[model samples]
Target: MRVAFNVIDETIWFIDRPHEPWTVQAEARAAGRLDDERLRLAVRSALARHPMARARQAPWRFWQPGFAWEIMEEPQVDALSIVDCPDDAALARIRSDLYGHPVPLATSPPLRVRLAHHAAGDVVLLGVNHAASDGLGTLRLLASIVRGYAGAPDPVPDVDPLAVRDLRTPLALDGLPGRIRHAAALVTELRRPKARIAPERAGDGPGYGFHLVRLDAGDTPALGSRRPPGATVNDVLLAALHLAIAEWNAEHGAPCERIGVMMPVNLRPPERRNEVVGNFSSFVTVATDPEDRGRPETTVAAVTAQSRRVKAGGPPGALVDVLATPLPRPLLLKEVTWGLLPFVLERGLDTAVLSNLGRLGEPLSFGADAGDVAEVWFSPPARMPVGLALGAVTIGRWLHLSFRYRHPLFDPGAAARFATRYVGALDRLAA
Candidate 1:
């Protein structure tokens, strides 16, 4: 599928500050050793393994040729003051600076890396350009880099990054008008007016904090049995989230009758799975109103069914495919404009988003001595206007979830409370 508007531009940005550059050092402690030569070799190996890293084309254009690297042995004294500052604050500063930053048209700066060395040792700050990669892609790059360090032969076959000859082909939209009407009917049945659930208790607190919690693999079964035929961890997780939000609303005396979750669906077919690249995905919102929650078992069942239906029915990108074949540039632009302008003007139409990327492959290791990746967490952007985004992924057998919220709408404590309550809901459901 063609890239989305947000994906076309560089949606992700990172800043490399020296003092905290070694954050990966702590991560290394969990995964393996952090040897300098091995790290460099690992990066080279990743470049070789993923063709996108070396690709030079439009749409599928992956990495920029060169990276911005700076060696700061002793940064200015002013830098020391912000050394201990949190990542969010640093990112906010970078966002402000972005307005004046010169982003080259033809040759944008490649992904930036910062090398900081002091008496303590060396720390590398790798800043990825978001449009070119997702969290999974970044993890793969790191894993490949580590494997190269250990001289391990590539685990997967190297596929040509641009080999998808008909990647732009959209799914058949025959009877689309009828499908839209049917979907509208389902939505109308599931719809509930938005309720202003009370903000998290720590709504006016300081910037947010990220905490990692590990649930035992053995106990995973206790969380909940798979729904009859089979239900994914995402389905279970969604059910639990729905329950938690329901409970939270009840506690605040502003019980929300329904809640919606915007779910992202990756459009890449099974054959093109190895093509590591940008956001080749679209989404449909799975909404669960109060009626669905009345019968808990039915609630989960309906959610599972609705999620499957949404996945089966293609979204706007599917329409883009049919138009791309015959429409001229001007007409195509106009068509795209007509399609997306309303959503842009209305902000996002969904209330909250829950993106589950399922299980990532084998544990990613950087060096020969690298250990399997225990868990992976991705925090999607909580763009302005849209307040909340939840993401979860399985690395090995562990499930990691993150809740991202806009500062104006939520505080760290509130997020923590929500997490606590959500986990509690899951535990209760498992019981």
Candidate 2:
């Protein structure tokens, strides 16, 4: 637990920019709920195996090389336990509570859980601080806790970790032209104007709206076959999202001719994505034009083509040259914090961030406590500078989608309506 923050971790912290409660909140809905004590104890045990989970900020001298996460012990397991809430306010309560709880740097553990009971079953909200971990890391932690709570003895991986290969340098190839092209593309992107964000409605607060909807089994797999024969489900979803945003904007009188789509691709090497527990992902923006929204086949083709081009050019994070730097910790922080992001997004950018976590290979179970998970919804951070974010995951035949957006950029009811439009867009494409 005494590891120093990596370049990516420091970048995430700087992006958090004042940590206005930066968190990635998710909901796991299951048919049966685990007892509070059982869930709490399971989390406590899981934390023990992953000391980084309970790592807190410790004192460091200015020239101590890098910032380290110091392991800290907790007084009570229930500190990260669950709470029951009425069915009516379940979603609202979960978002409100999770959004407000940013595991401060000095805090022991940057994660929390809350359970809400409905007539159907339970919705467990897992909130994790982004600076400490990403959405996948949080999901991995939850999976381990569920396994532990289910009475699986020694749920932690038994093997020694693979030798630490630099995550960004996993591939060794000279693509100088590609790198130059990427740099030029980014410069062009920053100079070009973007689409307008959704207009705000009366009473929209500073908080983001959360909406989750499930696609039936019939619709889920169909997404894999939309028009383009080899296009993945993610490509289809991203295409559909383009249409949904355009439609939503048109309906609201703020029609956008072209929309920017940002998808966070897991940058962890093929073998280490599961082993690593941190923010190891980079943004991949696919092309979206106003014309594609009107023609379903063209939209899929455009998305599939653009996705292929981006991947062939480089892995998700091929252009982040920070991995090559060996500078003083303080100077590195100041450079990334002060020089990079603000130069690109000084004016808010109207964009959609879609993170497709796909599925857990197997259904999630909480052993003797909570039964198999019924539904799962995950959403990446909906930070400023971006207008909309969508997270998608499939559990069994159900494809659960969650739309996250903050105010002024989106009205309180915007997420719900956007989701409805998204479903409609998916249906059109799946047909």
lDDT of each: 0.47, 0.66
TM-score of each: 0.67, 0.87
The digit string of per-residue lDDT tens for model 1 on 1-431 reads 12232221211222211211101101112243345555555565556566444322132222332122221222112110112213434533432232112222122222333322322322333333444454445445555654675677667535544443222443345555644554454344334344434565434322223433456544665343523344556776777777777887788776575576666566666764534544455445566778888755656776778767666765532322322333223433444544553354333245566766666655654444555444355544434334566767666667777675655555666767877887776665542
**What TM-score, to 2 decimals, does candidate 1 have?**
0.67
Question: Best candidate per TM-score, number?
Answer: 2
lDDT of 2 at 167: 42
Candidate 2: list runs displaced more than 4 Å.
17-20, 60-66, 72-78, 153-166, 171-184, 202-204, 220-227, 316-340, 347-350
lDDT score, candidate 2, position 424: 82
- lDDT score of model 2? 0.66
lDDT of 2 by residue, 1-431 (tens): 36666555656655663324567776777677667777778778877776657766666655555666666766232446455666646657666667645656776776777766666777777777776676777777777777777777544444432223234454333554544555555555545566765665734355566766778756454475433576778888998888887877777888587677777667655654654456666555675777776698788888888788767765433334333345446645556544665666544243778888886777887664567888788887766657467888887778888877766466557667778888888778764
For candidate 1, the clash count comes to 3
